[model samples]
Target: MFDFIRNHKRLMLILLALLIVPGLGLVGVQGFRGFFDNGANVAEVSGSKITRQEYDALLKEQLERMREMFGGAVNTAAVDTPVLRQILLDSLIQQRILADEAKRQRLSASDEAVRKTILEIPALGALRKSDGSIDTEKYHDLLAKQGMTPEQFDARVRRSLAIAQIGDSIEASALAPKSSAAQLAQLSMQQREMRELVLHPLDYSAEVKPTEEQLKQYYDTHQKEFETPETATISYAILSAEILAASITPSEEELKKAYQDNLATYQTAKQVRASHILIATPKADTVASAKAKAEALLAQLRKQPGQFAEMARNESQDPGSAARGGDLGYFAAGMMVKPFEEAAFKLKPNEISGLVQSDFGYHIIKVTEIKPAQTRPLSEVKQTLLSDLKKQQATQRFAAAADQFSNLVYEQTNSLTPAAEKFNLVVQTATVARQAMPAPTAVPALANPQFLAAVFESETLKGKHNTAAIEVGDNTLIAAHVTAHKPASVLPFETVKQGVQQKVTLLQAAELTRKAGEEKLASLQQSKSTAGFSPVIKLSRAGARGLTPAAVSAIFKADAEQLPQYVSAILDGGVYAIYRVESLSPLPELEPQRLTALQQQLAQLTGQLELNAYLASLRARSKVKIYATENAAASE
Candidate 1:
């Protein structure tokens, strides 16, 4: 891939320039002009200029895609610059690999194919009219709104199609068999049911006492476990979400107006429960056909309002709603499209609206009731308003004090006394472990990189100076000086004696139980009878009920040929269990739908595996050089 890119660099650059030149008028290529000027130009292949700017743009797009995939729940702080750079570089390398491969294979898409693919994309599709033909004016208007020209849009689509073609060819070759689907299904469907009995070694400790020498030896062997974990005494300032919320304070006038404007939102709208018969336009793109369909539906609705539900059940294209006799039960304002919402909201009780056009098609709405909106008095909302007001006030106060506090702490040099005195804030201390000093919910601003970096710095712990103030969250700041520090060290032997003794006892008990269970099972298998056994244990055909993983594992290991197999292992709640499988059953055959779904899943898995393999191959062949130190310095 690198060789191809290097050899065809000039050609690739020319092709890229040609492709993007037209779009430059709209997208402004100035931002991207010097993208590869300083950075090492990694690859430019087949008239495609893979510059730093281009890579960054792709990285941003990928991030946006991830945000969309996660429904916008991803934390911005989690997006590390180094990680994003690596991802972008890898993606660019893979594209170069595939592009080279495509060229070598002479894989190409025809003009017609490219055009068809572009037109089929929903973003590019023309708005539908009564007839099926494209609505040119609507398409033009949409392009104008997006600040793009048809030619530029088409060119962009062409490049996308080219990339997709290369990807598809590689993916198609990587497809695997559907039989894997059945295997996966079997694994997922496999389940075991068993009963368990647990025994604890501690229960028998009274009967067997260890010698003094043995106890001493155990204590000497394991000292670390009994010792406390390394601890740190930290001074922290907390900025809790609840505290922030409490700080806000809303004005009485603001509260009143907010309540009045959103009165409808507070009250439940009277929902009309009605069904409709829809005769959709044959071709929504053509004005004439849409008008005709609307007119015909209007005539039918006017003639017999009673048959609407029956007609909808018989003829509605919306199968999901049609199954319920077109019943769109009780929707309020904003529930439907603009046209439908307007029509529904305007109708009186038991009144039917004339034909209305929505994006879906045409609709005939019937009103079942006119539910009057409800309102609550100011007194009822007074408490809520007060809480909001307090939160606002707190936020403002915190913001005002943060800068002053930060300056005071720094100026104090080695003490939090100045800041504490200036703000009347308590200087709190924590005896938490270094690993746990930053509480799980500490504000990010308070735990900023500077503060964390300072914590690990030797000078900060020596009490040379107070650490710089850190912004942990909105309107929150923190600065700290470590009052005491304990360097990490191995614990003494005496501290861990009890823990070692407990471990030894548990190991010994497990060994004893395994041996005893093996002997019992062997005897049952050979004797074929419980005559000599102290107690004849009854085994259920389905094995034990409600068996845990540990118990089941222990029991399954017992000699199966032997009857009355008794194995005891520690289970939950200080108990042990033993069991034997009296019988085994095979799984039932797969149902039709399940089989089809499994096959589809297997196909998708195969595609993903192929893509992964291709990426791995590209990485292996590429002349990739990473200057990690240089990159880190640049980022810093």
Candidate 2:
């Protein structure tokens, strides 16, 4: 269930409704005074509260997971506030439904079950010892590293397990009849063999010549299709982030001071090298036994320190570092589990520590080396400081220019030339049609509603300056001018004649093909062969590619090999009449693995079908209210 939730995160989030604020009126009634307060209340499902802070954390984690899944190709910024809100809201709703159902059914995860599931989680199992015990110190350190207390982590794990158990119960009971599987398999295995010959309409083009009067009549009837669409030409002022960034400059002194103030950020921390042996416990309840085994291994390590690498290579449960004699290469102070980090950092070179305990099991660490922290010189990051300073200055400059540009176009009612002259800005023109599209520069201002509204305004189109400067990004703004305009008009007929003719021809062809196919099927059925078919119909042997599965099944199920027969089937492009089934062969018996896989697939499909049907039933019964207009206004 957790895997399913992770895989279909977006869908799960939507179904949960953990984030979205439904309506401003509802929000106000719920005691939300402003946008921030409303947004902070992620969702209230029944009486359960999903706060904004919790939703944001989950959203961030999900984004990080997605980034990892896509190998970082996805733009993090593209996952905007609305999208995140929807995701959280969906997740919340799903959880609410599940929780309610679970409570009603008295279905809950047992303490033992929760513990077992937690023990299986790989993240918590990474700190074990060679003798299979939970490394207490390492466990504490791991919790500290994650900024979570042990109790808090355990509670979260328990909640997750309980939810998973509920989901499992729901899915486990879903079933499909054996007859349904057999029917599906039969349909899937069905095939058809047929022959076809296409007659192109263009072949009769020479016979389609019409009188001038007929052509004129056709043109008169379909005049609208030939007319041109309304078009517009607009002059615009571009204030882009790159342009602003290029214009602003920062002094040398500023860069040095900025670098000095953030000294820790420009310094590299000391790293320690260590190695360990691990033994894992499959269940948290077996920690006592695991600890005993860890103690035995610890004694062996104490007796022979030189045998550490050999023992780690042979016994460590960590596949990642076990192959390399359990060598955890150089890691900084905060990188390792807290207990391990503390022990490793405290040790001198070549010093070996006693058995270390963590969440996974027990471990014995040896510090191979330690490097001192070093500060980076100002010269190394001077360019980065300058760039940051420039962006700040550019943002301010762009804001000032944007205000002036807006007033000039809206208030003064003058041309763009005045604003351009004042700001040393160039006037640009767009070849855009009435339909909205991103500008060549991908400036957000050009695509904004204000700009779009202004472009269509009568005042802006009539050579009057009725426009405004819009912010595109942090340091980008746009001031637009309406240069040309054309009123909406209907299309003319001549341009649409060919298209209509093609449509009519295709319809005629389909009808003709169906009629021919039906006749062929009848004749063949009467004679048991293609003995009296016209147009020199040929018989070709081929499997079904486009025919409906039901039709294909009827053909294949018929005793065609014993007696030649005719079967008609509707295909995507045309109809088909298969006159004979030349042969029949039983497929090979399914392999054990293939059979198992098929069963699993069938089970999953059956479960999904049941789940979908249940959700559909819920949707039918529930009163779902959508405030789309309100939500849209809020977004704008």
Candidate 3:
């Protein structure tokens, strides 16, 4: 593959320009301008426009990455929605805006800085040589596949560094006031000395029973609460790939043929395990100067091959492998760049190559051990091959069978009986509601949502015919017919009358409880008596195990303008508690650790405020246009 690239260098360069020019020089590259100008653009920042083509490619990359990261756990429906589309567009616009600003400010990263940043990045680090320096040629190929050029990648990296500088300056300028910190610490540490009078709702339940007239009135006014939704009883027939696959058997001749047809996959390529010490020369040093330095070191290595590891340890320029004496673990042929791979694979075990020139610079490589090519026998992989063959046969049959399945259901119209009989599938029945409630992050299922929709479609709900085959999951389809349709209706008043009466009585009791508590608290404040008050003790904001946080907050919010302040609130489990704050305490100094934590929290808040302010200014100054027409095109 690479030989074509070397032989037709000009043709490869043209292909790279066609694929990568739009991204690197979007506005200025005339050859690609007509494509973006005539077509729609999703968003534009400053002078740089993110065309529809760019947005779609980025979103596709993000989706594929998500699928790889999540495997079977990925929810394609959720991830493919308009919200994710908008988010990706916004991120691209933001990067362009920052890049524009970096150019305006004359901020730049040297070639050495760009190379260092690339090596530090985890994704790019995978292409590093044995001595730790990045493989320049592999990096270029990766960028080409990503629809970007090396210059574009460098620009993006420079913009990122500039943005980080802005964030750092904002965070450094943020300082939390010491007095404000002290105040927060005091509030967080404050404690309260209080007592409560609890009133249970059940205590008033018996004295406030409702009349027959009231029960009837409530049932009439609140009919929606007692109504039943429309429902349907339907029968469905389904065909599954797994069930079909189990019924078919592959003969030994078939599995053997499959193995022979795809023989390359059954073989493993030759692997070479070699270590190297690289002399650094990534566009910084002249080729002649670098060659002279590399050949001088080559002379020493040839004199003493046994001292290769010691010489590599003291002199190698690759940071990643230098510490380990340039030990690169086992690798395959295509894993490394073409030039490096060719030189490494040519030499016998322990044979050192003379100075070799490549993109990164000249290098003297020592060949280590090589494992010969290998191929597995049919006996070893027979089981796996058999399973694959069965699945392939099952899939073809399922496709041909599916068209007939859909046709039978639609043609029969009245029932699922004909389709079920033809495929020998069981006709399953279910009673489901009209609502197709969403299961946002789950695999679409047979009964939960689409089934609800199938039974509720206008014609089916009216008992006209069965639903056409609906694909609810991979290699699975269902066709449902509504046998019985029931419209929504209100329940009989007689059935729910007793329950309604019980609810009315409880509501009346709660009102009575509130009024009684208010009257008793007023009398207590005036009389200054502990008549029936519960025992009082001091407690912090974090109340006892039984008391809730809401109850604690309510206690602190009580009227504290005078002595013996009173406040009441309904607590959980249908009880009302009236609190009396007998006295107030002055603020006290907090522990050293508590004070430190409080200060750190305040500092974080201040930093967030600064960051938001900075971003707001950025958005206000930048000319960001999101074209509605382009976004609509994307939606379609």
Candidate 4:
């Protein structure tokens, strides 16, 4: 049950939005019911409609999340596809279905459960007062950040709890039989000894020469690659949080007060390194038997303290740390459940504790080390505090300035100079395209799709006027005035002839290399020859050595039941590889911790399958309508 303590903060945000914020849905339902029937209704569950506006908003949020998850390396075009739109719409419909089902089943959580769950969540720890009660003011501020009120947040949390019950019931019923788990584990750990011979593309490059006709044909078929994108020279103005922050100066007294207000954030808590032996109290085990088993282990440890690690390795039920003799590593206060944390902190280094009862089970902990708490002096963190204060002030300033900036650009229309003068921003000029080229000198804000779209709008381009202000970053806005434009045009074949010949030659070379590799595989299968193969090496799903996943998969997919199996894999970088499977063997008995982890993984997989099937059944029983062209619900 304490596993919830390890839940990620991102998941908590997703959970808070279980079925859309109550505030948004309430407004939309109250005012847009008429519009829903004709204009923008994307889906509906029961009597509630999912508006196209809501769908688009959710899609944008999801894409932003993907961009954040990949550190902005995500390709927007690749992610924002028709398939993704349908998938997101289906997901929204499922969430609606679950919410309706919760209400139909009258699955609202008790006020006490809601209170307890909110307090238990580590992500919300900052919202708790010193007296162990919810900090009402802070809680309100937190909800307000998500555009929700306290009542709305509580209702959402309650609904999330109720929806969780549906999943919990299904997962609790899922059982992965021990035999199935072991068989799966065995297959995963099964090893193959193999040798490979590769055909390099370079080896065949001399055999295939590209003619001018072939190069022209290739160029004709792929003209888009040879065309220059439409480009424009524009003057743009940017109003950003950093620029605002640069102009603000905070007083020393203000900085000190800010530092004092967030003192907890600057203090390092005391940490403990400990090892534990847990006797888990599953539902199948009686409390008395479980505690009795824990007591027995404690008694044995008392008689032979040096045998703690051995006993823990043999008996601990926690899969995560059992292999390292139950070492839990270092953890600060609030990291562990209350009962366990209290007992652990009371112990001295090298001292052992008696059985301590917890939600998970009974834990016998041995403290190995302790790090004293520390507090940084104000002088040490003054610069950081000053920077944060300025940023805070700038954010507030930007919130007000953003509106004025938008108005100024929209009203002026002819030039960005007026807004630039008002905000003290420079009217910078850059050459840009509908798609920003990847170059060192390219302007980052110009790469934003919304900003670029505004720049390329028909009205803005034809009139040589300023585009409407668009948000390009956090508290950052951009407006551009088009000065010159160039239309897209294809390059002559003569201009790209050399590049086309290199491409055609590479394609031909790769094909020849693949064909040669296939012939080698056939020869090896018939002659049982190892003349051209590398030294034998072992491979398993768990360990692919340095080979690519595709190569490893091909090696395993070969008929390994019989010896001397041959397989071919076309790898990236225009290389083809042929492998000879020499032998196969089952791994030795798995390490105790690995075995436990595998069993847990198998159980989770089984539970996930069960959950998916349950959702499918729920969808079938509910009335879901998709107004989009795909109409995903009709297929279901």
Give the clash count for each candidate.
Answer: 42, 42, 0, 0
Query: lDDT for every model?
Result: 0.56, 0.60, 0.70, 0.79
Candidate 2 stretches with Cα past 4 Å from truth are 1-172, 193-196, 210-224, 240-242, 276-323, 337-343, 346-367, 392-405, 418-424, 437-453, 462-465, 468-479, 490-585, 590-636
lDDT of 3: 0.70
User: Per-residue alpha-carbon lDDT of model 1 for 37-153, expressed as tens digits?
Assistant: 465443444444455545545544554557788995443324433455565555565656555665566665577865665455555434754334456887878877655777766
Q: Write the per-residue lDDT of candidate 4 for residues 4-23, one digit (tens) a residue.
A: 52234223533645534323
Per-residue lDDT of 588 in model 1: 65
**Model 4 worst lDDT window (10 residues):** 26-35
Judge candidate 1 at residue 59 and give its lDDT: 42
User: For this target, which candidate reaches the highest TM-score against the unseen true structure?
Assistant: 4
Q: What TM-score would candidate 3 get against the native?
A: 0.61
**Alpha-carbon deviation at 395 in model 3, angstroms:** 6.5
Q: Candidate 3: minimum summed lDDT over ten consecutive residues — where?
A: 26-35
Give me the displacement of residue 635 in model 4, in angstroms: 11
TM, every model: 0.53, 0.62, 0.61, 0.67
| 494: Cα error in model 1, Å | 4.6
Best of the candidates, lDDT = 4
What candidate 3 gets wrong by more than 4 Å, as runs, is 1-130, 133-175, 238-412, 417-425, 436-451, 473-476, 524-549, 559-564, 580-636
Query: TM-score of the candidate numbered 2?
Result: 0.62
